[model samples]
Target: MNAVEIQTHARKLYDAHGTKALAEAAQMVRELEQRGEKKLVEDWRRIQSALQQMRGPNVS
Candidate 1:
């Protein structure tokens, strides 16, 4: 997905799942990597990064 599409999907995910969306994205990344889905893994990593940016830095 393009940057815009990634951001849009990230926003939708955040809206639907809140902070849990980050975990969901991370899970997807891991699964994709294990499946050898390089392209999808890259996209999901982008989604995960976007989620982190949306959630801001970890406090603890």
Candidate 2:
């Protein structure tokens, strides 16, 4: 997916699942990696990164 698509998906996911969206993306990455789906893994990684950015910086 392109950057716009990735951001859109991340937003929808965050809206639907809140904090769990990141975990869902991470799980997708791991499962895709184990399945040897390089392209999907890459996409999921991008999505995961977008999700992380959505969370903003962590505060102590």
Across 1-60, the per-residue lDDT of candidate 2 in tens digits comes to 999999999999899999999999998889999999999899888998999999999999
Q: Write candidate 1's Cα lDDT for 1-60 as tens digits.
A: 999999999999999998799998999899999999999999999999988888897798
In candidate 2, stretches whose alpha carbon ends up further than 4 angstroms from where it belongs are: none
Estimate TM-scores for all models.
0.89, 0.93
Clashing pairs in 2: none
RMSD (CA, angstroms), candidate 2: 0.8
> Model 1, which residues run further than 4 Å from truth?
none
Local distance difference test values of all predictions, in order: 0.93, 0.93
**Candidate 2 lowest-lDDT run of ten:** 40-49
